[model samples]
Target: MIEPETVIICLRAAMLGAGAVCFGAGSAALLLAPPQVASVLRAYLQPVLRGAAGVLAVAALVSLAVQTADASEDWSQAISPSALFMFATTTHAGRTSSARALLAVVSALCILLARGNRIALLRLGSLTAGLFLASFAFSGHAAMHDEPTRTLQEANHIAHVLSGTFWTGALVALFCAAIILLRRPSGDQVEGAELMLRRFSPAGVTAVVIVGLTGALNTWLILGRAPLDRGSIYQLLLAAKIAAVAVMLGLALANRFYFLPRATRPAALVASIAIECALGALVIALVAVFGTLEPV
Candidate 1:
């Protein structure tokens, strides 16, 4: 049987990953897409954003309870008001998780109440989603350090997560747009989609670069050495995560260089991007596992 802690970690990762997809996709649409294209994307994305944020809020609360129980090593304490209060009030992870839950709630409400207001979605929704992601920095491995190192680790973690989410989430948006365009073929829509892809290429490249750099820095900071120990579960998971990322990079390169140039073959483009999204999901799962493990 899987441990409750592991289950909660997976739950947190899934919710946070889905939330990132909304955030990155929305932000990319606002920044990279033409007004008409963005409007259409928004029509598809807003519902997802609301749903993911709502789920994230609920998952955060549920995870908080599970974490409290795990921390207290007494399953009954999961529902004990005093234990819950102490955990939420006293622990770094508890405070951060609480903040994340609040941010997720606010994000959901902003999208729900905005009700087609682009400005509010862009401002309030993005602000809350960004904060939700940033909350992870205050918990987990990043928060375990002292003094200036803690600040440095936290900032690096934020950059790492933001860039990673942007990369994976934008791929999700691109895949959705590709599928829709393929279904309802249009010259203008194709042109807009192509333009969006063009705009995303450079940004995606930059985000991936940051993810690599900051990820390496984070690993070094956490393990205090290179991650080469195959004997340890944490190291093995880390290696698997790295391999998945490398495969993603290869797929991205193929999309950028091979499939993208042949714009007429959008089926091929769609296939490649879909694969990237799948791999991105895999990476999130791997991170969820390794993130909960102690490095060797």
Candidate 2:
């Protein structure tokens, strides 16, 4: 049976993970997508980002309350002004959660009401998204280690998250493009879609490579030379997450090397991308659970 605290953590992780994905999609549109494709993608991404940021802000506040309650060992103290203040100012976890909440609100406002040129808005969104991703490291397993190991673990985790989010988010963006522009598209739309794929390839490939390399480094840093105990729940969940990622990678490769070059079957391309997004969602769900578990 899952504990209440575990459930809260899982919920928070899911919300934050989802928000990160949305942010990644916006960033990918701004950075990797062509202007023609990006303009269309933003129409789909803006409201999603706004909703995600709002969710993330709420999750951060709830997480902060939960952490305070745990630290005080009194449920009522979750809202006690003195207790909350002490926790927020004195504890690392509390400080991080507060920062996360603040950033989430800022990101949401930026997305919803900030008036700027297209480039300015995109730049603002990217900055907020990167900062949001960085906050996750402080509250994660990486913070448990000592000295240089902690710093290295944090860096590795951040890289892993950035790359994974970028890769998965780009897949989502690609799916949207396929749906909007590729179904009985005009000649120019078809050409734009193809150009989007070509532009995405380099960044997508790099993100995949970073995710794999950093994930390996993170596992090693966390567990050291100890063999993974198959009997442990943590190990089992970890294994499952890895397997999901591996399958995602395979799908990505197929899309890049096979379907992408052919470009004739819009339906096939859309189907493949949808499948990858589904797998990515699975991986995020697994992460929400295993990430809260202790490694043996």
Candidate 3:
């Protein structure tokens, strides 16, 4: 049985991962789609983005509180305003938590302010979301390294996360667009979905490449030449994540090369995308488990 602390860590990681996917992917989809399509997608996505940012902010605070409670061995101390404030202001974990909270707040504000045909507002919101996603690197394994190595690892981690989320999240948005197109069959919506898919193909390929490269870098950094022994839960989970990602990549390639050309069949395309999204969720769940295990 997993310890309560491990469960809490997994929950925290899952919330953070979900928030990253929603905000980062929404931003990417908004930027990648054509203006008219973007406007429509934005209407569908803005509420989700705002809600994700709010949840992230609350999750960051709760994570800090949980850690405080664990360290102090007193629930009251954890909830004490003075303790929370001091921790947020003083400690490294607290600082990262505060930064995540601040970023989420800023992202939410940007989302709220972003309305209508203002390209600048959209761009601002997108940039803020990216920044919010980047904040995760500071609090993860990348932060454990030293000096130049730490900077490099963090950069790679940021790239890995942003690219992964962008692909998965954009796929989700596209899936929704496909569903809308199927139900309503509007000419503009159909055209927009096709155009978005075409544009996304190249970007998706690029993002996958980056995710693969950075994932390798992260594994190397974490394992330091250690073999993937079955005794090590982290290594075992890492292997599982890699295998899941491999399958996801295979599905993506199949969708882009085969099913995509037959774009007339909306049902088939949506099914393929839906499967990919499920696999992506599995990868995220594995990552949450990874967060709970210490790397050797």
Number of the top-ranking candidate, with TM-score as the measure: 1
Poorest 10 consecutive residues of model 1 by lDDT? Answer: 114-123
Q: What is the lDDT of residue 244 in candidate 1?
A: 86
**What residue runs in model 2 are displaced by over 4 Å at the alpha carbon?**
1-4, 114-118, 225-228
What is candidate 2's lDDT per residue for 116-172, written digit by digit as tens?
345675567556766876677887686889987788888888888788877876676
Residue by residue across 53-172, what tens digits does model 3's lDDT show? 566656665777766665566666668988888878888878887777676666656666766666566567556667777777887677889988999988988998888777776777
Which has the greatest lDDT?
1
Off by over 4 Å in 1: 117-119
Ranking by lDDT: 1, 2, 3
lDDT of each: 0.79, 0.74, 0.73
Predicted candidate 1 versus true structure: per-residue lDDT over 1-296, tens digit per residue = 45678768778677668667767876776778765466666766767666766776777778888888888887888799999889889987788777777888777677666556556655677667877887888887878799889999999999998888888878877876666566655666777777887788889999999999999999999988777887889888888888989999999999888987887767988999989988888888878878877878
State TM-scores per candidate: 0.93, 0.90, 0.89
- Model 2 weakest lDDT span, ten residues long: 114-123
Q: Rank the candidates by TM-score, best first.
A: 1, 2, 3
Candidate that beats the other on TM-score, 1 or 2, i.e. the better one: 1
